[model samples]
Target: MAQWFTKWIGWVRVIAFFGLLFGLIIRIGDPQPLETLRNASFDFYHQSKPRELTQLPVAIIDVDDTSIEEIGQWPWPRTRVADMVQLATAQGAVAIAFDIVFSEPDRLSPAQIAQDNPDIPPTLLSKLTALPDNDQVLADAFAKSRVIVGQTTVRTIAGNREEKREMAKVAHALIGPSPLPYLLAFPDIVQNLPALEANAAGRGIFNALPDPDGVYRRLPLVMSVQGQIRLGLTPELLRVATGGDPFAVRTNEAGLEGIVLARQLIPTAHDGTVWPYLTPSSRSRYVSAADLLKGRVPQGRLAGHLVLVGTSAIGLEDFRATPLGVAMAGVEVHAQVLENIMAKTLLVRPNYTIAIELVTTFILCTLVIIFAPSLSARLLISLSVVLLAGYVGTSYYLFVGKRVLLDPSFPVLATATAIILISTVNYLREERQRREIRSAFGQYVSPDLVDQLTQDRGTLSLGGESRELTLLFSDVRGFTAIAEEFRDDPEALTMLMNEFLTILSRAIMDQKGTIDKFMGDAVMAFWNAPLDNPDHARAACRAALKMIEDVHAFNAKRRREAARRRKARAGQKRKSAPARRKIHRIKVGIGINTGQCVVGNMGSDMRFDYTALGDPVNVASRLEGQSRYYGASIILGEATARALAETFAIMELDVVRVVGKAVPETIFALFGDETLARAPLFAALCATNSAMLQAYRDRQWDQAESQLAEVSALLDKLKLNMADYVEMYSGRIADLRIAPPPGDWDGVFASTSK
Candidate 1:
């Protein structure tokens, strides 16, 4: 009966926990983070699926760089714009839209020049004013064709903006609750010149606001200005091209359902915005304005098409960011919107999407809670991954097949959290005995050893014991310089350091070594401690070599990245290539020592840590610090080198007495594996180096100097940079030449500090 009650209470707690999580997600809906996830998911869908190949019946008349160069600069005489419009109309265009706004009167108009110079004679001024006004000439061309003039909505000024009021020509008929309260609204309107706007068939706002991330992913179909709802330029052009049909906008309590035209229904969000599916930019979608005027454009391309006149010239400053590329013309944004509408391939995130997500989260969480308690941790994790994959797959399918924007992050997150919570509960219940063991040994041993202890708790105890262990110490070189690189961004520095340390630690663990602890940018680890391995020395050596290989690969990648960045900056001519190509490489020095050491918990009574302590451990640490002095990445004590002499290519470095130690120790550096050691050049150098060391120790100064010279020449021939090793021998010889050592002198260098 007690077990039954406990199980019932456990079920209650699980349900309550999931219920609270579900409720929180529903209340918050899709916050910025969730929205960002949704956007990324949609972008993935966009990239994976083949874009619609049905060429949009729309064409953009671009004032591209070639057009601007050939036809002179922008604000080109109003007469020239009129000529392009006339040519487009002659090519049988169904409707023409001006993405360019004639907000101010033409500056070069005769009447404006006359007003600028008050000294002009009255007769001349009368003749100048009498000449046909350029604005009127453009109006005459507009009067002859089905042209939709673009306008803009602006923020409210300090005073009354009555003078800037311009009504959009499209009529809006509403059904159900009005969506104006939810629509993005502006206070004033910037319209084209009165003569030009009055003569056009229709006018609408040409506003294309980007998403929070600065990508043009959606098009606002309807916006409000000073309590008045209006259609945007593309919608207005569609309406005018369809014979000025009135649009009936459907709405419910949430906001908007869609807009109904004469022959098609366009779906939208609550605020009457539509997500556009963009394709890669195509040169075929554009016809240069100059080509249109010069009759160079193909005849059938513009016929019966809705033409949007805009510029792709870089100097125009009319570019927008898109998911597909760095920059796209703003006019192409409108063209894609119209294309999606006509193709009936519009993407929509309706008001009920949140409800659907909530249901998914609730159902998934319940399923996890029901099955998790009976399963082991491995199976539970597997089940959780499968459930997550299913949710994401379903969400992606809905997006690809149905054009629905459903967020999978919340559902997946909720399920994962539930699995974790229930799994923790199971752990607590099933591992009661192991929990007691962990409570005692967790702080002193690694998790692996702790588990082993649980299996056989007799092998481990709280006492000091001596074992043959290989201790490794690794530290970053030039860490201060690396830190200074990000002095202003400490968080970034922390992330970089953590990433590097993780890779290094992984390298060590990959060789079956146990990490004892991390000290700043350094890692201390040991082998053959908790578990007896006869090859611990070889494993430590391999781990050190692997660390060096990993750092080299990392530096190569950084250098390549830096080169690409520099090339990009150089192409822009903003700075010199050398100035932008500063690459900072991260380097590490590792040292390994093999000997018998006391491997057990050591510290104060209040707190103790599992570590290795002995002369060999101290030697390993000193060698790591000495590696930079020798200009080598890995330096191992003589014992470690002897253990791996048959496997690794080791070179003798020096015999030195480190600080606080009276005994001299021999250190060696690694070159490569056995294949490198078998090379003839390496064999010869090693033979000559050994002879040189023997001669120097025997006080044969002339012989020692001659052998050292031979070693230097061989190193130069092999293109090896072992200058530090050569410098040590040269300094020793020079000192002996000045003041020879006594006959008892040994070939050992003494170091005063670590």
Candidate 2:
């Protein structure tokens, strides 16, 4: 269970890293939460340090409450408006723009009054009709001055008055693809009266679009109205003020870049909108229309200044929310737009800023994922704080120094989330590793070793590491024939095999060995893994001897039980005879080898085992197989024998090459422990065995036979069974006598089977 979690920990991190990046990509669509965060940051920037009103090139001719009271309400006669226009032109104003649209003819006009009142005398009506039309008078005044009339876009036309609507005349020099697809479109426009629109030098739309929070931060400089492109009131005012020929709209595949007027470029957002860095509403920027008309305005106030005429009366409902958290007159917004542009203080969020923000966020989040697991909690928190501060600091600096808007909220949030998730995964992985260590090694190793493994987890590299390990492989000899005794009762066979394996496994665990796995009747184990054991070779040899001794005890107990069962069956009645069952003695061969190997968890990510892999492990299995051929209970490779040369009674078996190996390995057979090694009889037996092997290698068949008999006699004296060893050489010597070995024979016997 721990292995399963351990393998997926890395996957979890990868998934989280890319998952956060995908979320950042989704944020590019500007979901509500992310947009709110970004907008709040931008709002805070403006609120903290609004644009300062340095030079007032733009002035508002506000029709304030005082003006409304002084001038007798709105919708005043066109003659009165014409008089104000004439006065503004006489004051040397460069351009006068109306934020209010004169969409209908003045009802106070003399001709309209005449038409409304039919009861008047025919001669009086004729005299009134002979007087100049009020709209015509306003048109004459407009023609005499540089005036820009206002228009507004609507979603739908109220009635079938489209034929009477006048479109603004704008010359556009496009540089790339058409911007119609990228602009805010409206089906119709509320145009000024034909006379006022035709006489004006320029006409533009006065629509101030608000953000989602209903705050006017950015205003469109260009828009699509009735399938035609038209300039905003402020941009048109600049055009007339500079006398620029045509607007050079720069664009690319990514929507609008900027618009050029009089060779001066004005950068805009993708939708051709410009963010007006607004100042606090100041009374100094406004002059009452009553004051202007009454000759109360200062002399130079209107000189060289572009004036915007609009109503600020509360009854007009022209107020808008600004980023400063205050409601401002809509006309004042236009005046501020012109002021910002003319003063070169407009805030710009370039199109590439989004791409830059996304890339930065991804990189930051990736860094968090990569480092969060390794760093301490305190260090991670400090780093996160630094990173967040850096983002906000850079954004604030750009906003204050460069007048550029870049939001840091999303990056901060994303990086923090990555850190949290990756740290959590790391924590869980460590916990799992601890559980795995305790669960896997609790019974096999000592408590101190388990504690060491748990405390120093870096040593438990599941990916693998090369180490010198003493590997042991053991299998039941002739297990197929043994199993035939219980073929009709498989449950009994399972019980017998479980008991037999338990004894062997306990022997290995007693010496702090790791059980790699079991292959039916075979058991594979290794030492000097997961924890260091300098005496691993000696420990493995001891385990092998212990397993053989335990098996012999198990056989004695089984024989006693079988004999007791037979006595009970014989005493039963003849008509109720018990079923007869064959009993087999359990014998095993163990092989031990010491060499360099890679030991760790090995398998697929989903399922893996802590085991060792190398040629040494395979050689151990082949040595165990050769034990049966030599009639020995245990066998050891040259490395293991060399380590315990004097510690145990070991005899050289042969110099034979195992399957899959080109080099011959010197093999040894285990007889007993140190007590037997010091025994005089064992020393004599070893001398005889060495002489027999020497004579066999020298091709002296007669002397080899005589020495083999002496070796058998010593084995009988020691009460040991090794007839198969004597018979194997006897057959080999006979074969060599019949067909002598080749001249190049080096006394090395290469095994043909595993």
Candidate 3:
């Protein structure tokens, strides 16, 4: 009877504990702790899986540092601003939204200048005063183009309450509760000049109200100003772009549900706001406003693109802190919001998210309390982890799969606190055993290896077995010249090499290849080890192609920088210093081979690393060294080429016997993969090249020379440079003609060096 009573008391205590935690979390609301956790959740999601490029045709016309340098300073003449509007409209821009506010008349207008100077002649002053006003010119441009002027909702002021607004209509109340009371409200509005505002197609409030922590996460889609609902800049632009129409607000008993604009339903919180998924800032999204004004922007750039005009100059103070990065351009915020809306990838956290979180917390905490007192230490720990994992998995499922957000951290935290409180004594007693285990293994292995050992100790072994793997070796061509350029600066050399390695390594890893090691400017990697990949050969080939593409992109960027520097120097009156030595046609040679190899932990048992060894590895290295001689960026051994023949565009180079191997092997150059193979020109070249190779191998000197001549002529007509290969083949044909080969010749070339 006493035991039953004690158990009942324990159940009562558990219920009371749960109630306490629940009340605490609910009372805290969006306080510092919960806000911090929410921000952390956002950061984790953003850092782990950021949004890709949006399909929306939205762009920003940034008045950046370069634009400022060329077009003088900020608050550029209103006529100039008008010219920008005209240019965008001329280029077929559907709509133009100003992130800038034209709240006052233009000070640079001729009338304003005439009024400022009284000493001018009366006739000249009268003419200047009679000239068209700059503000009026800008207003006329706005009237001609599809434009949306910006406004700001500020704290209630004395005179602005009576001001009229073109407010949004609450079309249909789909369910019981309305969202007006929950929305952010303000009494006053900072509007544009009457001339401009009257001419614009629409108006929107550009209110960048950050969260309590000053992080701009959610953008208010609709807000109440002076008891009148208004749309945000993003939605307003869309409305203008697709015929002007008022949006309908949908609601349920919980409050706001979403906003329906035409046929599209945009999910929003109870407060009529949306959580926008941000991507990194892109220069591609921006065209210089100055460029538009000067008519220097490329044609069709503004065509069918939603252009937002704003400034990114640092002193403009139009920057906002976001999860993507701090001091991000404010214009990008609206641009991404528009992008998410159009792409239908906007993040939403409905009112029910909180209710679901509270219920989950209560259930999880109760389970932890019930299970903590009855299990062994290890089982308890495992159970706790399982519960935590389940909670997190559910949360991520909702986030990634269901496109909903549910807070798992609060519940998991509460559960952890409950378990820790209940198991403190037991945990203390077992700490010594865990410490001993750590001492035995911590010093000898990496943290990842240690984790693997703890999960399953059976994997600990010294010897390795053979596996069929795809091996890759890449080396920088003309690396000595590159080193010479950086000889005076070792730190710069180190940084450059690190960046190059990182780019190549990333290309390999992105294709799921494991890097074996870095040998100076070269890197060796393998696929289908540590993790099995059926597409290992294809992945290695793709990685080599990607590495080449990366190098080309790097060289193009450098060339642009060099051009900019040269231009800057040319404009200077003083004699400029000699231009820095530049690297042109920066190239890398990649070799790939597929065959059997030994792969596992290598080196002494006390200190070892995962690596591969065998004949295939040696051959892959040798082929990489030979890529330069073949005048190809990528070379593959026979096995790899055979595996990928139908997938990649292959050009058979030669059959060669390396120094150690007596058996000659066929090798080929990889031009491109499936995409390139589909090209008509590439296919034609491949067919012709194959015929030429056959004639050369058959010892038909006259036929081979004729085909080679045709190939060279075809290459010239196609503007393709394969001169080195053509020259090498020509020399081979000449030498063979002078000294005929033995009748038993198998057409094999012996290479004495690796």
Estimate TM-scores for all models: 0.76, 0.55, 0.56
Q: How many pairs in model 2 have backbone atoms within 3 A of each other, for residues 3 or more apart or on separate chains, i.e. clashes?
A: 0
* lDDT of candidate 3 over 1-754, digit per residue (tens): 9999677558545564766576556635756777678777866776566678755688888888777778877788899889888988999899999988898788899999998998999999999999999999999999999999988877866365555555434333344456678788887778898899889998888896887778888889888877777888888898889878667777777677787786688888888888888788878798887777777888998789888888897667899988765558988999999998888888767667777777777777777666666678789889888878987888887767655767767777677777777787446656777767777788887766776766775445666779999999999889898888888888988988898899999999999999999999999999999899999999999999999989888888778978888786665423546757665557898989999999988888698788998999999998998787778889999999999867997878889887688888898989787876787777777788788889888999888888888878876775656687788889999999999899988888888776
Highest lDDT model number: 2
lDDT of each: 0.83, 0.88, 0.82
List candidate 3 segments past 4 Å from native.
5-30, 157-178, 425-754
Q: How many residue pairs clash in each candidate?
A: 0, 0, 0
TM-score of 2: 0.55
User: Clashing pairs in model 1?
Assistant: none
> Lowest-scoring 10 consecutive residues by lDDT in candidate 3?
167-176
Question: CA lDDT of 636 in candidate 1?
Answer: 89
Sequence-dependent TM-score of model 3: 0.56
Question: Higher TM-score: candidate 1 or 3?
Answer: 1
lDDT for 483 (candidate 1)? 84
How far is 689's C-alpha from truth in model 2 (Å)? 99
